[model samples]
Target: MESEALGHTVMDQRQGHGSLVAVAEKLTLEEINSTGAISNFGKPNAPSPAAIVACVPKNVHVDEVGETEFRISPSEITAAIKAGLDFGGAYRC
Candidate 1:
């Protein structure tokens, strides 16, 4: 798999250097709701990209992945979903 290959590459580079660690924590439903990105009204509110990003926890430490770690954030996922929706809408147009 691509990820396994990437991990091997990272391990190679960090060999005999020191221990490298990466932590990924799943977001709880409560945490997502606490972001206020969702509304209590019958209709849902569209959250700004910044607001979505704000909801993501930064406690996870990633090693040797460069900036690719940002891809896992809530905001990035939301943006990707929105883009997919937009593409689907365009196809319907």
Candidate 2:
């Protein structure tokens, strides 16, 4: 696939790197309920783009849990450094 498929928007150089990373955790129901888009998924009577779930998670927490966010922790940064990974720059939309 071509990054140009996204049209005139500035593209990331690594778009064509064909990289896939594992999702370490599943979202809690509370987290999923935070947005209609996520909650609509996996429902038989879901709305458009959700009625037929394409990607199903192996697990989901039905009970309440802490909200999750992707934060670059200091330990993670150190681990990345040890792994010889470099930050390209601040993420862009």
Question: What local lDDT does model 1 show for residue 1?
Answer: 80
Summarize candidate 1's per-residue lDDT along 11-70 as a digit string, tens digits: 555653444333114555566556543432222464334332334554555686544333
- TM-score per candidate, chains pooled: 0.23, 0.20
- Give the top-scoring candidate (TM-score): 1
- Candidate 1 residue spans exceeding 4 A from truth: 1-71, 90-93
Screening candidate 1 with a backbone cut-off below 3 angstroms (N, C-alpha, C), the clashing residue pairs are none
* Displacement of the residue 16 alpha carbon in candidate 2, Å: 15
lDDT of each: 0.48, 0.43
Q: Could you tell me how far off, in angstroms, the CA of residue 64 lies in candidate 1 after the best superposition?
A: 12
**TM-score for predicted model 2 compared with the true structure:** 0.20
